[model samples]
Each structure stands twice: as structure tokens, then as C-alpha cells.
Target: MIATLIKLLIGLLLWVGLAIVAARIVFALPRVQDRIDSTALDPADVGPLAATLRVRARGQEGKTGIAMLRDGADAFAARIMLADAATASIDAQYYIWHDDLTGYLLLDALARAAERGVRVRLLLDDNGTSRLDAELAELDAHPNAEVRLYNPFNLRRFKLASYAFDFFRLNRRMHNKSFTIDGRVTILGGRNIGDGYFGTGPAALYVDLDALAVGRVVPEVSADFDRYWAAPCVHPVGPILGQARRDGAIEDGLAHYADDPQLEEYLEILEGSEIVTRLSAGDLDLEWTEAALISDSPAKGEGAARREDLLSARLLKAVARIESRFDGISPYFVPGRAGARAFKALRKRGVSVRMLTNSLEATDVLPVHAGYTSKRGTLLRRGVKLYELRRKSASRTPADTLGRFGSSGASLHAKTFAVDGKRIFVGSFNFDPRSTMLNTEMGLLIESAAFAGNLHDAFDRELDGLAWRVEMDGLKTVWIDPESGEVTRDEPGTTFARRVVLRVIGWLPVEWLL
Candidate 1:
């Protein structure tokens, strides 16, 4: 009888544990939805708005050079802001806005706009800024600037357990970048705000990329921002600020940070870039062409309510369109068998697919390479053009810190693709399971012969100089280990165990969750 009682107790405990987990999952969703819904704004009609916001370029014609591709971060930011100022309203969003020197400068600019009543709305991912609650409150104090966090961890309610319990929520991040100004011009691509993004870091500056669009497409970017603002993912600053109850504490803190020397220098460097001057004058010269605004969210096509998000749907569309040539560059590429198969299909259709991704030695996430290496055979078999970027030569000198500071140990973090040398895409969508199935992503598809040609030339330069071209051998192929810079013939015995392990783990299908 005692034994029976013990068994019953054990079973009851197990059931309760399961119940708690399920309850927690259910509890988290509404909180996420409430935050997303609060900031929702009506999507403005961008066509009529575009003309009013469009600023014609004037004054000195700047020197156009191929080297401008490596323009510094300060230059990029300043240029975009100048393009944005021509707008009637500006909407900017990102995952991280650091508290460092660069962060304050950008914040100050936004604050100035708010003071001018530029109708500025800034949406930031909560996980990246969770620790900066106090800092955010100060920025929000800008009368025209309203800042909100997407799926924030409510420090007041959740408290000590919040960090631990909020892991799941933290995983589904909003990895989108869009800056729409005056409802006319937009810059959409894979940059976040920080020293790392702007080349002002102590480490190497990343070879990142962004796109400038002017015409019918800016509105689509605006619509996506409005959707997220109103979605259940974003939460207002009121509740968290109210909980902190620091009152004017945030505003004062922002003022102090805004005056820091690092920020002042960063801003100065930015304003001095030729690109900044050109963009400020609204002088982007290009023929208007086809473009599409793509956004990824757990709530994808069916919108935010459904269980499966639309990131994959948009990706598949991009892939299907790649029925011709598949040219891609992603910071992270862990192509599983499924991803390999997709590439294979393109190859079968006689598409010349070339990809450039980070080397394992340069990759920040080693485990992702573990997944990528396992699938190289499939990619090579499909005749896809594959290349991995080497760490830039240490002997190379600095070009211009127009993008960001720091240039010693940078790795590639760009997510871009060009199809048929006509259509191109750039944004936060990495070619990995996380981007496909978990985190919400965003990118802009630009159909511009001019822009596409420019990007194609850039890709060629990287292919010839910075990338290690992957090629096939007889029955086997060649694998180049980045760390060693040694080429080894791919035979039966090369890391076979590692391949087996990856196959087993990848077969589980939970990597998308990971």
C-alpha cells in the first residue's frame, strides 16, 4: 500500500510539471501580443507622400568610386539620415541600439528630429535593450519620439524569474531593419546600431551592406513597420517606465549620454563622409525599378496570430524566383539537407547559383559550421557556386571609416542575394534555421539594373579577392579548412563521424527551434 501511494505521488508530480510548462507557454503569448498591438499605426499611402518627401540632389557632384562600397559606418548613417530628413515622417527600427558613443549620436539626431516634430517612431527589440530600461525611458522622453520594446521581459512583474522564464520569448527576435523618412526614401538592410555596425568598434569592422531606395517601394517598408508596431510583439514604454517610476530620471540620463565625446566624434566622422553630404542633398541617381518589401515574423502570412510565421514563405518566394541564377551572401549559412535540396533544384534548372558565407575560423558560431560542413557534399553535387570569405588580410590598410570604426578582426555579417543580375535583396534574413523558422526577419527586394549592376560588381570583387572558391574533384571533392588554409581531398575518412553526428541532430527537425 505504501508503494502504491509513492507511485501515485510521483505520477502527480510529473503531470504538474508538464502542466506548468504548458501554462507558461500560454501565458507568454498574450503579453507578447499586447506589446505588439499597442504601437500599431495606420499604414500611410506612400505614393503621394513620396513626391512631397523626395529631396532633389544639388550642389557639388561627389566623386563616385568603386571603393565607396567600403564607406565607413558614420558615412552610411549620416547619409541615410539625410535621405530620411527629406521625409515628412521617419520610422526607424532595429534590434540593438547600444549605449556606447555611436548610440548616443544616433539618439541625439532622432531627438532633434522629434524636437522638429518629424513624426519619428523607433521600435527596438526588447531582448537587446532589456538591460537598458533606464536608458530607453530617457530617449522616450523626446516629445516627438516614442520608443517601444518588442516582446519585452517585464522586469516589474516577472522580476528574478523573468530572465530565466523569458528564454523562449527572447529567442523569437525581430531581426528587421528599415528607415523610412518623409514617406519617400528608405534604407533597408542588415545593419544594427552600435560601434560594431558603424565600424567604430575596437575590433574589425564588418563588411556589411545596405540599400537606398527612392520611389514606390518606401511605402511598403512603412507598412511592415506599422504592422509590427501594432502587432502583439511590441509593448509601449509606459508600463515598464511606470513600474520603474523613475519619473524624469530617464530624460536626464539621456542628456548626459548625448554629450559624451565618443558620440560627438562618431557624429562628426559621419557628417564628414561624402556619401553623407550627397544623401543629405538627396542626390541618389538611379532609374526607378521593381521592388518588394519582405518581412519575417512568427506570425508570417496569416499575419501574427497563426502558429507558423511567414519568414519561410517569403524565403521560398525568393528562392522560387531564383529559378534562374542563385547568388547569395549571408553571414550565417547552415544549410541542412532541405536547404541543400533547394539549391539542387536550382542547379537542375540550369541556374548558376553562387554563395558566399563566413569561414568556420571566422564564424562567431562554431556550431553552425558544424551543420554547414555536413551538407557541403549536397551543395557541391548540385553544382552550386560556393565561396567562404577569409578574414581580411591584416596587411590591408583602412579605406574610409565611413561605415563604422575599427577594422582589425571583422567577419562578414551581410545577408544579401542577387538574381539574374537584375533583382537584388538585402536585410536581416540569414540562411539558417533560426531565420527561417524562429526569428522574424525582413529584407527589401530591389529590381534596379543600376543597383543590381553595382552589387554584381561588388560580388565579383569579393569572389576574386576575399573568397575561397569551392570546387569539386573526381568521385570526391576538395574541402578547404579556413583555419589552416590547407586544401584536403574529400575522401571517405574526412570527419565522417562529425557528419554522422550532424545528420542525426539535423534529422530531429528541432534545429529550427534552436
Candidate 2:
């Protein structure tokens, strides 16, 4: 009996030892070896025409129409241009294109472009377009247009195991938005094609931005598009569907659905779909600037730029170069300790800083809001002017304006920043860690005084009404303290579960993946 007990104890010790070694090996394999060196723009790549480009700052149609303010306007403009001209081909890549009015409008615009005898190539992430299978097959029926889903997981293509085998792979999504019009204009940035982004109606809207570039920048955008188009991950729609033979009725059903009288009513709700009206009405004053299209070149090594992944680094470098002041605004703010320290160093340099992010109640993602609120005290202590947006329906602010038949209120989704009234950065790059580390984001670094000043004025005028200033009281920060307006002090600790989850996540060495 004693010998039997000894044998059992010895076996348990061996199992535990093996488990520890296996865990260490698994963790070590995924660990990133080094930090990426920030890349710089090549002087040759800046192009000569950019030197002569004239840029001016223009306001949006209304507070609720902020989507028309950025890439939505540009994309709409490009689609129109393609429809009007473009005899050869058109290509677009996007991460998200919601199956709402805005998405349908884009679809209609593409159909019109095809109707005008233009070959249209639409590449969308599988994760984004999988649900729109019926819509996609309908678009594919077009003789001149082709819609392909990248890295599809559907069993129709013999990829059934891909669905059940791996779930984490889905999280590593194709978070890129790019479009090329007649190989002339290139629109790249973070704004997905949806009404929520275009200020259709404040349903947990995110204040985001995108960039539109003409001239030489378009080619770079085309290159990125081509890379993804050629990638094995992106399979042709015709071949995939050719195998599935999903049936002919799906197209007829979608056509009938499009003609539904309710769609007209739905269109009214999505003001962003009125791209043609805004463009024809001269809502967007096209600004030309000395802008060099910056993007992440394909990854080579520890610091090598990855495909459609370099824009984040370029934006950070631009932020780092700010000499006098740095103002940032985003709907989401998830800056960890290192990011907080970076802001602190900027404050230490006597740089007047201001930032606008969503409040707990204003945010749709409570956990993300919690992550941001966690850093409020740290940010406030460093002299950062942090503002949490308030619900405009409840509060009487000067910025509120009745928009779209008193239905939609303004939600700030504009990703813009101004530096000393000289340079401005606008596009999809956000201040959050997710934007910085994981997601591949794009935007324009505009060095135009006119653009910067106009954005600055808009922000100044809107902040007083649409947002509440975050201030430090003692150890905590407050958004709307019943007594002291918006003050900051010590915040409550995270729940035990959240703490445990965050601790485990913090140890993950996937900064490259973010």
C-alpha cells in the first residue's frame, strides 16, 4: 500500500512539471522579439504636384452630417466620378459596410457605375460581408461588377473546417478601407460604409475619420488594393458561387427588397446616403494639400511595415513631431500606462493639450469606457484637457441643432486633431490602444493652415455644448458630479473578473497584433 501511494505521487509530479514547460513554450513562441522602428516618408514619394496643391478648410452640412465631413463625402464623390467617367475599371476594399441604407446606396452607386460600362471590383472582409451573402450574390449577378469575400469560412467553398476549427483567426480581421476610382482618386481611412459612421442617427455612433487623396497617392492605394486582390485569402466570387450554385432566386428577392417602399423611408433616416445631394449642393469644399500618402509597406522583419498596416505608425510620428500644442478627439479612448506616460511627457514640455472622448453613459461599449475611465485621473494629472461627451437630448448645449426631421442628434465621429494652427491630421486613426497596436488604420496628415484652423474652430464651438470637460479633483476624475460640474478624483476599482481578465491580457505579447 505504501509503494502504491508513492508511485501515484511521483506520477502527479511529472504531469505538473510537463504542464509548466508546455505553457512556457506556448507563451514564448508568440512573443514579439522587438519594437518596430517608426518609418519616415520618402521625399521622392511626396510627389511634385502636392507642392502646388491648394487646400482649404470647409465645414460639414450640419452637426448631424459629420459623416459627409470626411471619407463618406469623398467616396460618394469618387463613385459619382466613376459613374460619370471611368471606362476601364473600379475597385474598392472595406472592413465594414453595414447592410443599411448607406450600404445599399453604395451598392446602388456601384451598380450605376457598372451600368455606365465600368468594371467594378468590390473586395470586402468575410467577417463583414458573410452575413450579406444574399446581397453579395445579387451584386455578383451584375455583368460588369464582381464582389468577392476575402478569406471566406463558408462550407460552400470547402472551408467548413475553417469555421469550426479556429475562432481566434476571426478576430484578426481585415480592418482596411480603401477605394480606387478609375485608378485616379484613392480614398483610404477608418470610416466604414454605414449610416452610423456618417451621422445617419445617433445609435451608438463613433466619432471617426477617413482621408481622400487625388493625384499620385491614388497609385499607392491601388498597390495596396492589388496586393489584397492577389492574396490567396481573397478568392474570386464567381468560382466560389459557381461551386455553390446558391440559386437564382436570391437575386430576384434582393431586387424586390430594394424596391420596397419602406426603403425610401429608410433612406430618409440615413442622411449620409444623400451623397449626391451634398456633393451637388457644394457641401464639401475640396481641399488640396501637400499630402503624401503614407501606408504600411509589407512586413519584412521586427520593424518592417505590414500590408495596409503602416499608417498607424506614420500618424504617431506626426503626433510626436507636434512642437507647440496637441489636440486629440475620438469616441473611444483606451490609453494604457505607457500611452498615459506619453501624454504626460507632452504636457511636461509645456504643450497645451486637449482631448475629447466618450463618457460611460455615452459609450456603447461599457468595458471600453471603463478602460478609458481607468486612465482619466492619469491623463488629467498630466494637464490633458479631457472631455466626455454628454447626451445632447437631455442637456441644453449651444451646439445642438435639429437635424433630419428632429430624429437624429449629433454624435462626434470625426477623427481629427490640430497642432499649433498649422498642421492637422484627419482620418481613421484613433487614440485607443486597439487602434495603435492591433488594427490597421489609415488617414491623411494635412499640413494646411486653412484645414487646421477650420477644424480647430469647429471643435472649440462644439465642445461647450456636446461634451463635458473632465477635471481632476484629488485622486479621481469626474464627468458630471452633481455638485462640482465635471470634476476628476479617485475612480472605483475594476471588478475582480475584469481585473483577472485584464491581468491575463496584459501578459499577452501581441503588441504587433494589438
Candidate 3:
């Protein structure tokens, strides 16, 4: 019996080894032929809207028109208006696009735009859209629309098996979020296309930020889209969905929303928005400033070894120029040793640094919270004024209009920072190792004191009701809520089971991936 058990164990090990080899060999084989002519569609052909925006931009003498999108309703309304107003082209890229209410509404608008002869190009990360393959292929069936995926897996059915062999390549993903219309206007920031981002989700709402930019920077954003659209890592959907198959799935899917009352109400709400009206009338409240659109090159993922090409490196150089104060906001704040040391060095130089991140009960990813808690003591000891957002909070003031109507819980997802009240950075670049080394990111750095001051004011006004201040009592840490003046020795609002899980996860050596 012992000999038979040993033989069976050996057979199992050999089978597993063979499976790994097979997976590697299959994934290594090229699944799609590289496009010979990798040229992008011309943005100059965009129509009269582009001409008007250029006239305005030239009037500002290279300064871009920037408007901060603080409210979720306003953000969603702005995108829908842009899609409706586009005359020639629309380009969009996102990390996540769910098939929920907001997602379908926006997609239906895009489909309508395509039907009217407007060219549409959509680029999405494969991992985020793994379940929407058929829907994306149907959308690609439109003659005026094209869909592409970045770094797709070869074996679509057995994704876990494929990951075992191609873990390194598949782990790196595109986390960019941007939308452009007519090559004239662009919206870029931390918000992805989903109900939670737009404040329509049934559960929690994400308090996020986006920048509506028009001017010379729009062309730069368009150029970035073009780069990604033409990269070798992108694969067209036509090849993924084989030929000789026309089932009208795309049309049928869209037809489901033809007379949707919810969609009609959303459209009505957008039409009545004051911001939309002002935008349509070309009377925008824009802070014209000299802004630099920074992005990591597509080659950053194609095995390029140059650190100079990294967005994080560029941001660090900007951070080095901070003179007095630095305020950072990130939902996933896993500042590894290097980041911690940088903050310490800044503090040593008499710079006041403050950060706002998610608390244990508020965070969606427990592993990330574990990594963050592990560094809480060191950061607090360094005199960093740290604040963690509460799971639920009451609205404080009129300026606390950062969420959607009826939003129950708030999750901090905005990635923004202010330097000495002189410059402001906003985008999808989280302060984590993954964003620093594994993914591509983009953002705008505006040299505007007014913008920076506005952000600072908003941060201050929302602090009392929205977050809990972290304080160290000798060796023990405490969370003090400013609104209620209540103190908690343990992680606030966390269940016992979750606390145990977090404690176990904290002991794991996985900070690099968090």
C-alpha cells in the first residue's frame, strides 16, 4: 500500500509539471499577427468643435482651460454631453467598465454616435473586461467603431491555468482612464466607467475627482491614446471573435435600453445640469494655467529599462521641488520602504506632509489595508498628519458636495496631491508599488495657486465629518473621530473576523504586490 501511494504521488507531480510546460508553450505562441501599418487615425479631421477649441486655446497662448469635476452627477453628465456633442471622433480608455446602469447608458450613447458616422475607438485592459468579451466583439461589429484589448490572455476559458505560466506578463495591466471627443476636449482622472464611480451604485459610492480639460493639452491626450491604440500589445477584437458569425447580439443588447425609463431620466437630468448648459454655450468657468500632461510611454511595458520613462519617477522629481507642505490623497496607500523614507526625508527638511487614505472598515481590499496598517506607526512617528476615511459620515457643508444623491458609504478613490499650495496633481496614479512599477499611469500637473488652494480648502472642510485622525498613545494607536469626539483603540467599525483576517494578512510578505 505504501509503494502504491508513492507511485501515485509521483504520477501526480509529473502531470502537474507537464501541464505547466504546456501552458507556457501555448501562451508563448503568437495568437494574433502584428499589424503591418501601425498608424493611428488622424485627429485633425475632427470637425468644427476642434477648430473652436483651438481658437480658445490660442487666445490663452498655450494655457489650457481646466475645470475641476468634484460632484459625481456633474462628472457623469459631462461625459454624456461630450459623447452627444462629438461630430467626428471619440476616443475612450478605461481600466473598468461594468455592464450596469451607468455603463449601459454611456455605451448606448457611444453606439448611437457610431451609427451617425462618428468614428469611435475604445481601448480596455483585458483583465478588467474578461467577462465582456462577447459584448465588446459585438460593439466592434459596427463599421464606425473599433474595440481593442491590451495584453490579453491566450487561453480565455482557463484563465487561472494561463496565469500560472504567464503570471509576470499578465500581472502588468494598463490602469489608465481618459476620454476624448473631437480631439478638442478630454476628461482624465481616477474615475472609471461604472455605477459606483458615478454615484448610481446601490451600495457604496466612491468620492473621486476628474479634470475636464480643453486646449493644447487635449491634443497631447489624444496623442497618448494614439500611442496605446497603436502599440504592439493591443489586439483588435475582430480576430478574437471569428468570422462568419452574425447573431445581432450587439444590437439586441442595446435594444434592451431603447425605452429604458431610467436612461431617459438620466438624460433629462444631464440636460438640466447647469454645467452642461454652460459647456454647450461655450461659457465655461475655466482656470487657464500652464499644465504639463505627463504619462508613461507605452514602451514602459515592452521591456524598456529606462527609469526616466516612468510617470512615478517624474512625479518624484516634482515632489522634490516642494518647499513647505505636501498633501496627498490615495485610496490604496501602500507606501513601501522607499516611499516611507522619502516622506521621512521631506519631514527632516521641515516640510509638513499630510495624507488621507481609507480606513480598515472603509477599504475594499483587506490586503491593502493590512499593508497600510503595518506602516502606520512609522508614518505617525515621522510627524505625518494621517487621516483615514470613515465608512459612513454625515454631510458637513455645502462644499461637501463630493458624492451622489443618497450615497450611504464613502470610499476615497481620488489620487491627488498639492505641493506648497503652488501646484496640483490629479489622475489615476495611486501611491502604491504596483502603480509605481507594474502599470502605466497619466495625470496633469497644473501650476495654479487657485486650484491648489481650492483643493486644500475642500480637504479641510471635509476632514471633520468624513475622516478620523490617527494618533499614537505611547505604543498603542487610536482613531479619533472629530465629529463625535469618540476614540477607538482598535480599528474602527471592523468586525472581529475581519480583524483576525487582517492580522494574519499583515504577517505575510506581500507588501511589494499591494
Candidate 4:
């Protein structure tokens, strides 16, 4: 009986191994190769908006017109306005585009633009849009619009199965977020298309930032969009989902959003938005400055040779130029050994290094918070001034007065860093191993003291009400609430179950994956 049981166990192991091998072989098969459409579309050929922007940018030369979008209402309104005003092309890319209220609103706006003879191209990461394959395919049925999924999964219905077979290939994702209109104007930063990103959700609202840029940087953004759009890894929706159905679901979806009573409140907010009013009147206050576009190569995910042109390397070089101070704000910050060493080195050079990240209670991803907790002591000991955002926070800035709707909670979702109050870096790049080695990211490094100083001042103003100062009391870490001066030795506001789960997860060897 013991010999028979041993043989059965061996047989089971063999069967499992065979199944894994078969799955890998099937996943390794060449992906569907459809016709490559590499036709170039110029944004300059767009309507009066592009022409006006070009004329305004002519005298600036290498400078770009940049306006900060801090309010969620204004951000959403700006996108809708750009889509409405676009006459030639609208290209958008995001890491996450949920099928929620804000998502449908943006989709409806894009579809209406396509209906008006404007060309629309949307590229979203496959992992973020996997559940919306049929809906995206339906949207692609529009004559003037197209949608593509980046680094798509082979088994769309059973994505978990594909993960088991192609973990290496499926792990890397595109974390870029950008919106371009008429090839002349673009907005890029951290916010994704979802209700949580905007301030319209019943749940937590994210305090985020996006820069609306025009002029010299517009062409650079357009080039990046074209590169991703033409990459072989991007799969068109029509081919993936086959012949598009002519069902009226797309129309129904648009109508559904239109009839939403909450939209009236949003529309009123849009009408009163200062950015929208200024944009509509052609009198936006845009600061013209020299900005460098930094982005990871698409080849980063294609298993190609490691290139020196990676965004992480460029960002490190940029950070090395800091002489006085460094202020980093990231929603998911997991600075590993290398990052700790870098921060220590900076502190040795007399550079005051500070960071503000999501707290245990504020973080949406518990694993990432655990990853950060593992290195909290090391960072504090290395003289890094760390601050964690609170679940309840005040407005980011005085200008962000338009979007307040008494949210259930507030979470820090902005990804920005400043160097000596001279330069600012903003985009989707997080201070984590996943962003450093596994994901493709992008950001704008503006060499303008005015913009950097403004950001720094805003950070100072929001520090007390929105964050808790973290410090080491001898060997123990403590969180001091900046508002009431209250102290908490434990993870503030987290439940017992969550704390236990986080403790278990902290023991896992998955920091790199987080």
C-alpha cells in the first residue's frame, strides 16, 4: 500500500509538470500578426485650435506652454473640452481606464468626436482593460476610431491561466498616461480614467496632478504616442475580438451616462471651472519653460538587450544633479536596498531628502504598503524624512476649490518629485522595483524654478492637514499626526484583519513584484 501511494504521488507530479509544459508551449506560439498600419497622422493639420496654439507657440521657440491641473473637476472638464474641440485627432493612453462613470463619460466624448470626422486612437494596458474587451471592440467599430491593447494576454477569458504559462512576458505592463488633442495640445501625469481619480465617486478620491502642455513638447508627446501605437506588441481590438457587432450597445452606453443625474452636478461644476472658462476664452495662464520628455523604451518589455536609454537611468542622472534638497511624492513608494543606498548617499552629500507616500490606511494596495513597511526602518535610520498621507485630508491647493464634494476619504495618488526647488518631475513613475525594472513609464522634467517653487509651496501647505510625520523613537517607529499632534505606534486606522494580512504578506519574498 505504501509503494502504491508513492507511485500515485509520482504520477500526479508528472501529470502536473506535463500540463505546465504544454501550457508554456501553447503560450509561446507566435501571436496573431495582422496588417501593420503605419500611416503618419500630423496634428498640425487639425482644426483652428492647433493653428491658434501654433501661432501662440511660434515666438516661444523651444519653450512649451504648461498649465497645472490640480482639481479633479477641472481635470475631467479639461479632457471633455479638448475632446469636444478636437477636429482632426485625439490620441489617449492610460494604464487604467475603468468602465465606471468617468470612463464612460470620456468614452462618450471620444465617440462623439469620432462621429464628427475626428480620428481617435486609444491605447490601454491589457491588464487594466481585460474585462472591457467586448466594449472596447464595440467602440473600435466606429469608422474614425481605433483601440489597441498593449502587451495583451493570450487567453483573455482565463487570464490567470495565461499568467501561469507566460509569467515572464505577462508581468511587464505599460504604465503611461497621456491625452493629446489635435496633435497640438497634450496632458500627461499620474491620474488614470476612473471615478476614483476624479472626485465623483462615493469612495475615496485621489489627489492627483496633470500638466496641460502645448508648443515644443507637444510634438515630442505625439512622437511617443506614435511609437507606442505602431509597436508590434499592441494588438488592435477588431482583430482580437473578430468582426465587430453592430449592436446599439455603444449608443445605449452613451445615453446611459447622459441620463445620469450626477452628471448635471458635474456639468455645473464644469461651467464654474476657472480652467475651462480660461481655456474657452483663449486666455489660459500658461508658463512657458524648457521641459525634457523622459520615458522608458517600449523595448524594455520585449526581452531586448538592456538599453542605457531607460527612464530609470535617466531619472537617476537627473536626481544626481540635485545639490540642495529632494522632495518625492509617490502613492506607492517601496524603496529597496538600492534606493536606500542612493538616499543615504544623497544625505551624506548634505542634500535634505524627504518623501511623502501613502500610509497603511490610505494605500489601496496592501502588498505595496507591506513592501514599504519592510524598509521603513532602514529609510528612517538613513536620515530620510518620511511622511505618510492621512485618510482625511484638506484640499491640495487654494486653486483646487472647485471639486469638493465631501468625499468618503482621500488618498494620495500624485507622482511628483522636486529637486532643490529648480526642477520638477511628474508622471506615472513610482518609486518601486516594479516601476524601476518591470514597467514602462513616462514623465516630464521641467527646468523651471517657478513651477518647482509653486509645487513645493503647495506641498508645504498640505503637509500638516493631509499627512503624518513619521520618525524613529530610538528603535521604534511612530506616526505623529500633523494636525492634532496625536501619536500612534501601530498602523493608524487599519483594521485587525488587515494588519494580520499585511504582516503575513510582509514575510513573503515578493517585494520586487509589488
lDDT tens per residue, model 3, 57-104 = 666977888998877778899998888878888899988887766776
- Measured against the true structure, the TM-scores of the candidates, in listed sequence, are 0.77, 0.69, 0.91, 0.92
Stronger candidate by TM-score (2 vs 3): 3
Model 4, backbone clash pairs (residues 3+ apart or across chains), number = 0
Residue 67, model 4: lDDT of 86
- The TM-score of predicted model 4 comes to 0.92
Which segments of candidate 2 are over 4 A away from where they belong? 1-86, 141-143, 154-164, 201-212, 238-262, 265-284, 297-309, 318-320, 393-412, 459-462, 480-514
TM-score ranking, best first = 4, 3, 1, 2
Please give the ranking of all candidate structures by lDDT, highest first, separated by commas. Answer: 4, 3, 1, 2
How well is each residue in 1-514 modelled by candidate 1, as lDDT tens digits? 9999999999999997787577567554434333424332343344333433243312212311111234445435654455335434668888777765556556666766766666678888765663466666765766666787776664544544554545656567777777766655567677777666666546456667776665566666777787878765577776656444465544454577565565576656656655544544445444445567777653542234343337567656754565456678887887766788878877888888778877654567656765676676678877887777656531132232113324546677778777776766767888888777667788877665555565566555545445566667765656554345578564322266755665676556555644
Number of the top-ranking candidate, with TM-score as the measure: 4
Q: In model 3, which runs have C-alpha deviations exceeding 4 angstroms?
A: 1-15, 27-30, 34-48, 158-161, 201-203, 243-248, 254-265, 302-305, 394-405
Q: Lowest lDDT 10-mer window, candidate 3?
A: 394-403
Model 4 residue 420 CA deviation in Å: 0.6
Report the Cα lDDT for candidate 3: 0.78
How many pairs of residues collide in each model?
34, 18, 0, 0
Better of 3 and 4 by lDDT: 4
Clashing pairs in 3: none
lDDT of each: 0.61, 0.56, 0.78, 0.80
| Per-model RMSD to reference | 6.3, 9.0, 3.0, 2.7
Clashing pairs in 4: none
